[model samples]
Target: MESSRNLKMKFDDLFDVLVKDLTENQPADTSPALKWFQQVLLYNVPHGKKNRGLTVVQSYEFLIGEKKEMSDEDFKITAVVGWCIELLQAFFLVSDDVMDHSITRRGRPCWYTVPGVGLIAMNDALYIESSVYKLLKKYIRNKPYYIDIVDLFHETIHQTIVGQCLDLLTSKEVNLDGFTLDRYNAIVKYKTAYYSFHLPVACAIYMVGINDERSHQLAKDILLKMGEYFQVQDDYLDCFGDPELTGKLGTDIEDNKCSWLIVQAWSKADNRQKEILKVNYGKPEECNLKMVKMVYEELNLRTVYEDYEAKSFQEISKLIEGIDSCLPKTMFNEFAKKIYKRNK
Candidate 1:
């Protein structure tokens, strides 16, 4: 991959162009509503690792190949679609923090938790979601695949919401009986996978004018597996990762999330171990956290996670090798490599 320094410089340039389009280019620049809108974009978007947005551009590069360069306008359009992915992510996070009652995000207070924002953050979140279409309409309205691209965004947002619903319900009462691998798979596939992995590649696929169902299906199957594996890594990091690096505090345990760690640990625990978990698993106390973590250690859950990681990587690699399509193997390989051992 190119240096993140180079990627950020490119993304930042496009971000300025987008800001102007939303503000000074269209409306009265001095309007208070425009000012608040600008603040929303400045604070919530572009702050994270930019992985999903980057994936859109990189995947398109792989599809377009070195011999056939797109027009400069086409290049900017793909990059802006990538930015749209980031905007959608911001929308999810701003609202998710409110729903999850989260404190910190990206190393600072969540939008909802920021003083003076409160419930107004909900409207801001909607604005962020709506902005994705606002962007697509302006930049890509004339493309043949414009309708397809719009439908893709609408479907992805819907799938992610469904996944979020499953997550909230699963953790509602913290009864360990409901924390199954099947349940975890569903949550990750919709909540994290569809948007993070599937949507970006699919967006690029449509951009390149490949509208056939067979190609899309093949890509989705492979990418969904990658998404599940990525979330597994995320679950591992939430507990063990540095808060300074992760830029968010881990609350999976306290929040009764059907996290990969807790579910795997539960399945491996003895009756006595199970009883210990039942007593302390979802409690918010420090002692409770230690007690649950101790069980994970005794079970060697970290080792279990490492083994799963290696196996998942191999499985995905093989799936890519066996694919039969115009979609480049290098694109899938690049994506697999990016998420395989990521720290943040």
Candidate 2:
């Protein structure tokens, strides 16, 4: 827990530096567009817990053994690149909130919902997108792996958009008759796993000069599994976690998310249960939440989550053991341990 706190503090400092640089580099003259861009970058990027960006630094430290201390210059450059990924996440979330009609994020008003910021948040999201490339070019251009990093980021964004499209399409289709375990996994991998988990760690691996196809493929395989586990836990927490700890009320049921818990519950439910879910799952009403949660409790969804959590931990341990000890095991293992039983 202490290590996790330190990692979070490091991420916060990096975010602050990146935001300061963005503001300073903006045009000196005061203009609404410039002001809006600054506000968008600041407000949206810094709101989250910064897990994604910190994963880069943590993975880098893992790959390049912490025994080999990083220079201040190297640490600063890596931190800046990590912050770039967070900025990209902000770009996606701001636009996604509009498309999803999300009213709040991280327990606060969504960027679009803020005063005088409606609709303009779309362009602000774009500004955040542009900033990612600018930071990449500035910090990584001279490295031999620069092109790979750029291509990876582009491919990741493309995959996430594809996943997002599938998600939107599924919500509208409304016929749960088509939903399957395979489709749910596909959406989770592309839409959530790749960016949330793979992109960050892979970026760090590339920075540490591990661009070999075999090494990257191995790293991605391990990281994607971790990503899946993380998202599964997130889905479980949405319904089961304390709102005070989670910072928002659970909405996966209300939103009809194709989450892991829903997929599992649907698989085991009887026809009668399925009908009840179809009617109540996605409706935005207080009574509907009660109905869906009742179904989850009746099915003992918490027990299912416990079983999955145990299996995921074991599988991750196997993956870690298989990794060549020549690489930094402690760093990767540290990351794995931090996330394995997280409560908040």
Candidate 3:
């Protein structure tokens, strides 16, 4: 019911409260561990667009009807759930950056890459993760859904970490023989989709008192598909998207990432093209990079991506249509619109 600007401001206020509360709970005064925790929390948690956090608030409001008045207390609780999702994301990304040996995030240095931080960022990531439970307990301890929410977060966390393990191991493999669409879907579904897409809406569902197993499972089915599509687009963009718009240069090529483009390109390559890719796919040198791109261009991978994008939208739209009336279809529709045709 509040304007988007007002809602965002409120979300920030609740987030600050959680941060301050968590900071107070940490060890007293100037300790290195405390300082590391504070620094990691500030840099990684709040730096993103906060889409996951905002989605909780937005989905709750949409489900309950924006025309319905929202109390300040209820709004704050909902916002806290959103912030919890952000914290979960921070937890994953900090560890992910370290694992991937990434250098930057959101156009800034990765937390681990920060001078004097280094491997400690992994532990800081743990602190960020632990903060989620801290906030949930402080705010939602007495709520009926507390156990359910905690369980959901734990399960999602487990799923994501498992997905990350799959991704890390898959990336480490030298041969392209293992890179297939099935593996790509598995990695994305676990590593990115669960936390990014499903967790936020599912949290809001619990908050809004939709606890029926059928409804929850239906939502999961719909959202996980959307999540998979979201990651596919991410893979596509990492290779073909504009760096300025995407906020970072594409590195999936050099990183030997199991990207959608790579899979599609591999599937379509002639023997010569396959030989070219074999010679040059994962090398970091400029000539190798150029050769890989040459293969992509020759195979018209860009057009393939366009066609795939169109089909993904159609499939997801049909899924949205099939969502039961007991659930708010518009909530899913709104989320789909946000991600549909996204370039960044």
Highest lDDT among the candidates is held by which one? Answer: 1
Cα RMSD for candidates in order? 1.6, 2.2, 1.5
lDDT of each: 0.90, 0.80, 0.86
Clashing pairs in 1: none
Model 3 lDDT tens row, 138-188: 999999999999999999999999998888887776888788989988999
Give me candidate 1's TM-score against the actual structure. Answer: 0.96
Q: Which sections of candidate 1 miss by over 4 Å?
A: 1-4, 25-30
How does residue 159 of candidate 3 score in lDDT?
A: 98
| Backbone-clash count (model 2) | 0
TM-score computed on alpha carbons, candidate 2: 0.93
Clashes of 3: 0
lDDT of 1 by residue, 1-344 (tens): 44667766787689978977776655565588778888888999978888888778777778888877666676688889999999999999999999989999999899887778899999999989989998999999999988998999999999999999999999885579789999999999999999999999999999988888989999999999999999999999999888988999999988888899988988999998899899998889999999999999999998999999999999999999988988889889988998888887
Question: What C-alpha root-mean-square deviation, in Å, does candidate 2 show against the real structure?
Answer: 2.2
